[model samples]
Target: MTLKKLASRAITEIGAVLDSALPHQVEVMAAPILNAKRIALYGVGREGLMMKSLAMRLFHLGLDAHVVGDMTTPPLGTGDMLIVSAGPGEFSTVSGLIDVAKTAGAATMCVTATPDGTVPQSVTHVVHLEAQTMANDQEGATSVLPMGSLFEAVQFLFFEMVILHLRDQMGLSANAMRANHTNLE
Candidate 1:
């Protein structure tokens, strides 16, 4: 396929996954975030990177957002939230962190392709993103993108939409979010 055709196919694949998402997914994910006094997020591999991107946007939206392993991530407790991605449904570390967050009286939200996965089943809430992940990417995968890329790509777009929703709900202007951007960068 030509480069442009390949790009178009990939975009279409990602869009199909996004379109499959439940209409309520965004609102379900955003509610705990808006209610949280602090929000910490985690994921593994490329999913982790996507989680970090969402964290940055959440911070820009004026929420107290942090990455789980960040040096300055404050401890989560009541009125706090832990958002995690487990595209295949479960990750050992993600599960452990969810346990910790729940024990601390915080809510946990999981974004995953398999909502029935162990980690997602354990979380306080789940946002299902139907896409190919490493778990089932080895054979007869639907996406032209390699293992787990579809999930990560769809995830990034989904998170951006969530950010936009939060921005509008909070009555935040783009300039307000920009003001929160790091000047040191």
Candidate 2:
């Protein structure tokens, strides 16, 4: 296949996944975030990179968002939230951190492909994003992208949409979000 063809296929696949998301799902993911006093996000591997991207955007929207394991991340407690990605549905580290956050009186939200997975089952809320992940990316996989790329790619777009929803919901202007961007960059 040509490079352009591959890119188009990938883009179309991502669009399908995003289209599958219900409006309620986006609201489910955003409501707790808006209610939280502090937000900590986590994921493993490439999914972690996506979570970090979301944290950055949330920060730019004037929210107190932090990535887990960051040096400056504050402790999560009452009125706080932990947003985690378990694309394949269960990561040991993700589960462990969720436990800790819940024990500390923080709400937890999980983004997952398998809503039935143990991690998702345990979380306070879940946003199900149906896409091919490492969990189901073996023989006969549906996505052209390898391993969890489909899930991760869909995550990037999904998170961006969530950010837009949040910005609008919070009555924030694009300029307002821009103002919160780091000057050091």
Candidate 3:
């Protein structure tokens, strides 16, 4: 296949995966971030990178968002939220953190390809992205991309859309968000 053909295929698959995500789920996920006194985010591998991107966006939005395991991350409890991604459904580390967050009285939200899976089923809220993750990315998978790339790519797009929704709902201007960006860079 030509490079152009491959790129088209990739884009089409991404759109299909993203289309499966429900708007109501996105609203529910964003609601906690808007109301939480503090928000902590986590994920493993490439998924973790996506969470960090979201953390940066939340900070630019003037929210108290932290990446879990970061040195400056504070303890989460009531009025706090822990947003995590475990796209195949559950990673042991993700599940452990969710257990701790729940016990600490923090609201837990999960973004996963398998909402019916054990870890997501345990969360307070979930935004299901029906993309191909490593768990199902073997023979016969629909995505032209390899492994969990589809899930990770859609995660970035989904989080960006969530940020847009959040900005509109909070009546925040782009300039205000830009003002919060690091000036040292």
Error of 1 at 6 (Å): 1.5
Q: List the residue pairs that clash in candidate 3.
A: none
Could you tell me which residue pairs clash in candidate 1? Answer: none
Evaluated against the true structure, the overall lDDT of model 3 is 0.92
Cα lDDT, model 2, residue 157: 88
Q: Candidate 1: misplaced stretches above 4 Å?
A: none
What is the C-alpha lDDT profile of model 1 across 1-185, one tens digit per residue?
Answer: 89899899999999888888845788889888889999999999999999999999999998999999989999999999999999999899999999999999999999999999999999998998989999999878877888899999999999999999899999999999999999996
lDDT per residue as tens, model 2, 1-185: 99899899999999899889957679989888899999999999999999999999999999999999989999999999999999887899999999999999999999999999989999999999999999899988988898999999999989999999999999999999999988996
Indicate the worst ten consecutive residues by lDDT in candidate 3.
17-26
Best by lDDT: 2
| lDDT tens digits by residue: candidate 3, 58-144 | 999999999999999999999999999999998999999999999999999999989998889999988888899999998789888
Return the TM-score for each candidate structure. 0.97, 0.97, 0.97
lDDT, residue 79, candidate 3: 93
lDDT, model 1, position 105: 99
**Residue 64 accuracy (lDDT) in model 3:** 97
Q: How many pairs collide in each candidate, listed in order?
A: 0, 0, 0
Model 1 TM-score, 2 decimals? 0.97
RMSD of each: 0.9, 0.9, 1.0
